[model samples]
Target: ERLGEREGIASLPRPAGRLVWVHAASVGETMSALPVIRLLAGQGPVLLTTGTVTSARLAAERLPERAVHQFVPLDVPGWTRRFLDHWRPDAAVFLESEIWPNLLAACDARGIRRFLVNGRLSAASTRNWRRAPGTARTLLGGFAAIHAQS
Candidate 1:
């Protein structure tokens, strides 16, 4: 399946109890999120969403007990909402640059705590975002905490 497709999202069963949604687009992001995922797993189940098969395989091999992988749905408002509605994660963690406007909006609408880890925006992207500061804020405001690169 394409990374940005929502074909299988609705079929996946969400485990009962608190679940943390951790999104990592690929290998690098997955590697960066593992320690955090493991920690979150200690507290509750973790739903690790990645955008590729390679990353999914890596996650399957390395994810701790109570941690599972799912393909991230397309960034469509309805699909994101469905994903969130079904899983009802207690919190969400986005690794590096994995921001999705629709997904974040759904999270905010649901009052889910959102966080960013090792986030970074390129200088050019920063300048572009500066051009529409309000949009940037609206898109990013859902994050309860943002741990950006130094």
Candidate 2:
């Protein structure tokens, strides 16, 4: 399943009308994102992408009716483009500290509304990103807004 899905390949067709894309990298993040995913599903179909098999299984068992789970495309520029081209999400909402440069750039280039929810960064991560300040700014600055939690 992962082999086929990794390079932006998906088995399911994108749903019609407004689609919101939410990505959470693992079980913990997925757990944190559930309520937000539920809220967004009320508005439109939500495509929730997770990176691990365990998380995908968890999402399958737990996700709401209007929410669909898929493995996130690998963070390659071409792969990201393929995923975005197929889905064409009206908006992209990402959880926690994930900072996928290629994926964010792809979304930005396509003019998709992007948001970061429960945004957080460890001191080490902050230091790492600070090392490449301009790259961090360009990727994160593209977000329409960021919703950080306590």
Candidate 3:
């Protein structure tokens, strides 16, 4: 059975208790999030979502027992909404800077707690964000907490 079959998402059983959703964009993000996933698993089931096939494979091999890996649905509103509705995550943790406006908006709309771990803002991106402070605030401000790494 394919782990990230989009159609299969609806059929996937919801975690029994609190569900924590973690978005790790690719291999590096997945690696960075492994320890965090383990920690979150101790509290509740963890849904680890990554954007690349390679990351998914790595996650399967390395994620802790209580963590289930999934391919992150596209940032499209409909797809994201379906994914979020089915998973109904209690809280969300994003690795690095994998920020998806639609996904974050959905989580914020639902009032799901959010955190950004090891976040990195490149100099160029910082300049762009600085140009549009309001947009940056609206998007980045949604996170309940941000842990940055130099």
Candidate 4:
């Protein structure tokens, strides 16, 4: 808890400006969001969150000057609530189909605008999504916007 308070809540030196919260699921998602992060950081602070140790390290090396990287907390309710309270990002961009139900619900509840970039639902995954009709519809409804690669 202390570590999270120390690092997670550290304020950016830059003046308060638009913050773009980029949530990437892993190394690939982290890498894919680099261009967007670079563009957005020029406007304000960028907080990059990934679920893997490797992605955290990679983003540290690769993300832009005003960008900070951290491992995303597990999507359990309490942890996510803490995370949301600390960061309080202005906008959120999720890369490559990372649709965490709890996280998305929290974001929605907070009125945090969200976008999904480079997204695709594979046939296998689509079948699974279909099985959970309520979950799929609920999750799908939360995305404010989506950008597909092709």
Best candidate according to lDDT = 2
Where's the lowest-lDDT run of ten residues in candidate 2? 1-10
Across 49-136, the per-residue lDDT of candidate 1 in tens digits comes to: 9888899899989999998788888888878877787789999989887778888888888899999989999888889889999979
Worst 10-residue lDDT window, candidate 3: 2-11
Q: lDDT scores for all predictions?
A: 0.85, 0.90, 0.86, 0.80
List runs of model 1 lying over 4 Å from the truth.
1-8
Clashes of each: 0, 0, 0, 0
Q: Write the per-residue lDDT of candidate 3 for residues 22-132, one digit (tens) a residue.
A: 999999989988888899898889999888889989997998888898888877788788888889999999988887888899899999999999999989889988998
Which residues of candidate 2, in runs, are more than 4 Å off? none
lDDT of predicted model 2: 0.90
Q: Give model 3's TM-score versus the native structure.
A: 0.90
For residue 67, give model 4's deviation from the true position in Å.
Answer: 0.7
Alpha carbon deviation, residue 69, candidate 4 (Å): 0.6
TM-score of each: 0.91, 0.95, 0.90, 0.86
Candidates 1 and 3 compared: the better one by lDDT is 3
lDDT of candidate 4 at residue 31, scale 0 to 100: 81
